[model samples]
Target chain A: MEIIKSPDALKAALKATQGSVGFVPTMGALHIGHKTLIQAAREANDIVVVSIFVNPTQFLAGEDLESYPRRKEADEKICSLAGVDYLFYPDVSDMYGEDEVSLIAPDVRGYILEGTSRPGHFSGVLTVVNKLLNIVRPDRAYFGRKDAQQLMLIQTMVKNLFMDVEIVPCHTVRDSDGLALSSRNAYLSADERGEALKISRALTKASHLVGKGVLESDRLYAEMLAVLEPLEVEHVAIVNRAFTPLDTVEVGNTIILVEAVVGTTRLLDNVWI
Target chain B: MEIIKSPDALKAALKATQGSVGFVPTMGALHIGHKTLIQAAREANDIVVVSIFVNPTQFLAGEDLESYPRRKEADEKICSLAGVDYLFYPDVSDMYGEDEVSLIAPDVRGYILEGTSRPGHFSGVLTVVNKLLNIVRPDRAYFGRKDAQQLMLIQTMVKNLFMDVEIVPCHTVRDSDGLALSSRNAYLSADERGEALKISRALTKASHLVGKGVLESDRLYAEMLAVLEPLEVEHVAIVNRAFTPLDTVEVGNTIILVEAVVGTTRLLDNVWI
Candidate 1:
């Protein structure tokens, strides 16, 4: 596997790929969720490119901007083992500059859900994703369904901008304790880690309710909130595939999302029907 | 020449083109200025694709969006004569949606000069321009130096986004009277048209003073302001190549810009040293 850092090198590597290219963009501390995305890309495309960029703009001033996790050596090994054709590792300086042009998310869709929770987060994600997409120009770009809102906003951005690349949404990977895989999970202590499982458990319980013919969004949210126990839940939203609030679930198109705060770290998970 | 209206069609046309493709994006009331850009594109690349989109988002609430000049038949004739390979003519509805992803210019650079005059204007310009460039994926994109600030911001956007396309800055086209050529120039009455020449004249005077060893930016702006007599001038300023305000003229690296209100229409012209 070729490891590239610069945009020019990435472009040259992309140009050399003869057929369809599948791209998976990440923040370096690769987990099973990222592995799932890469695995899908490997299956679908002749060439798979994985990018590890710890984009600075995506983190807010008070957020974990300074303390975001990094596992470059492990990430490289994971990509090598996952059969990635190219591993693009770019630093902050390689990506951003002073007095730069920026991407702004939509006023309505962008300001709700995860956007409202982490203000300016989606803007940073969309901006860096825009840059990566332009650089990779992949036939299909893989994103984990774990970040439901981020994936939604990115898909919206691609469609709204008329980007030719197809967005392949992969299912979330989980730990043995049912915690959705995330690099941030490393920040949690044993108790915090155990508490994080409630997030996924809540979503699972909501999915169970829906599976047993429960269509009311309120009931699903209520029961899921119960499973969340005494955790400081951020939001328990029941929305359709479009992220719009749903009064009644429509079997194959419903999504029950849960976000909870375990000390300083926040955990998010969802189940798609 | 092939005429494509849909985004998919344009991309396919782009893929079919051999060698470097030079792109000229305009709102198609083709005048001599647009002709100059087209001619330059023809000279630089094996294929040239001209896009005519009067992007509504770029216009403010009370701006002349609906009344914006468009000469479809004449535009087609000009493209044919200029040897354009493809003419991308997409409508406003086709270009925009209810919830749109947009580009926001940098706070400092965006909210000054023309951006200060018309709020949220550059964001719209950047968004539409970004979409156009992505669709074409051309080797080079051309822009009129008449909209000097727009050209600068676009260059910033392309570089900041790490896009592969080269930005070829084309000289502003002018009539014998020294009036900058613009589709909006048609909105001006014959008397207003004559008054518009003051913009170019002011820039000409500034250029001459700078050529003859004028080093002070303040004196250059003051003298240029005096030459544009009795006209309602918007701003007269001197800035470096990066559009950052210059205290002293840097000769070969300076740009002197002028904007004046000719009746109800705002006209801009600048000279790049």
Candidate 2:
């Protein structure tokens, strides 16, 4: 696997390659979730390019901008093992400049859910993702369904902007105990880690109730809230595939999402029906 | 020449084409200025694509968007004569949707000069240009230096966003009497058309002064203002290539810009050293 850093080098590499390109963009400290994305890209395309840049603009001032995980050695090994054609490890300088042009998220949908919890987060994600997509010009870009809102917004952006790339949404990968894998998982202590399972448990409970014929969103949400008792819940939303609020669930198109403060770390999890 | 109206058709046309593509994006009503851009594109690339989209997002409320000229028959003839391979003509519905993701212009630079007169104008221009550029994905995109600030801002956007397309700046095309050609020229009455020559005359005086060793920006601006007498001059700015105000002109890197109202229509012109 070739490890590249500069944007120009990656562009040249992409230009020299002949077949369909698949890209998986991430921040370092790769987990099984990232592994799944890379594996999917590898199987689907002739070229698999993975970019590992800790984009600073995506983090708000008071957020974990400074303390975000950076395990370069481990990330490189993971890319090598996964048969990545190119690993684009660009620095902050390579990605951003002073007072640059930005992509603003949609006013209404962008400020709800995860965006409401972390203001300006989706804007940053969309901006970085746009730059990455323009740089790579891949045939298909892989994103994890674990970040359901992000994946949806990216799909919206590509469609709205008329960008010529397909967005492949991969299923969320989780731990054996059902906790969704996240880079922020590194920040949790053993006690917090155990507490984090409640987020996933809440979604699992929602899925169980829905399977047993409870289709009303309010009743399902109330019962799921019971499963997440004593935790500081940010929100428990029941929405359709378009992220629109659903009072009554549609069997094949429903999504139950849960986010909570587990100790000092925020954790998110969801189940799609 | 092939005429395409849908985004999907343009994308497919671009995909099927071989060799370097050069693009010229305009808002219909093609004049001599647009001709120069197309000619440049024709000479430089193996294939040439031109898009005529009067993007609504770039126009302010109460602006001339409704009254803007639509010369589809004339425009098609011009493209055909200029040897354009494809002419992309998309309507507002084909270009925009409700509550879409957009590109926001830079706060400091984007809000001055043309942006100062027309608030949020550059944001609309950048957004639409970004969409058009992505849709076409040309090797080189041609832009007229007539819209000096717009050209500069587009260059900055492409660089800051790491977009992989070359922006070829074409010289401003002008009439024999020195009025810069514009689609809005159709709006000017015969008497107003004669008065518009002062804009170019002012730039000419500034250029002459600079050639004779008068480099002070303030002194040069005063002389240019004198040439634009009996007119409601908006602004006479002397700046370097970076759009920074210069006390003294830097030969080979200076630009003197002028904007004035001739009767009811507003006009803009500039000269680069």
lDDT of each: 0.88, 0.90
Predicted structure with the largest DockQ when compared to the true one: 1
Q: How do all models score by TM-score?
A: 0.97, 0.97
Score residue A92 of candidate 2 by CA lDDT. 87
Top-lDDT candidate index: 2
Per-residue lDDT tens digits for candidate 1, residues B25-45, read 999899998999999999989
Off by over 4 Å in 1: none
Docking model 2 quality class: medium
Compared with the true structure, the alpha-carbon lDDT of candidate 1 equals 0.88
- Expressed as tens digits, the lDDT of each residue in A1-273 for candidate 1 is 999989888898788769999999999788889999999999999999999998888888888977889888999999999999999998788888888899988888888887788889889999999999989989999999989988999999998888879999999888888889999998999998888888888877777777798889888878888888899988888888888899998888877888788989988888888
Off by over 4 Å in 2: none
> Which residue pairs in model 1 clash with each other?
none
**lDDT of candidate 1 at residue A179, scale 0 to 100:** 89
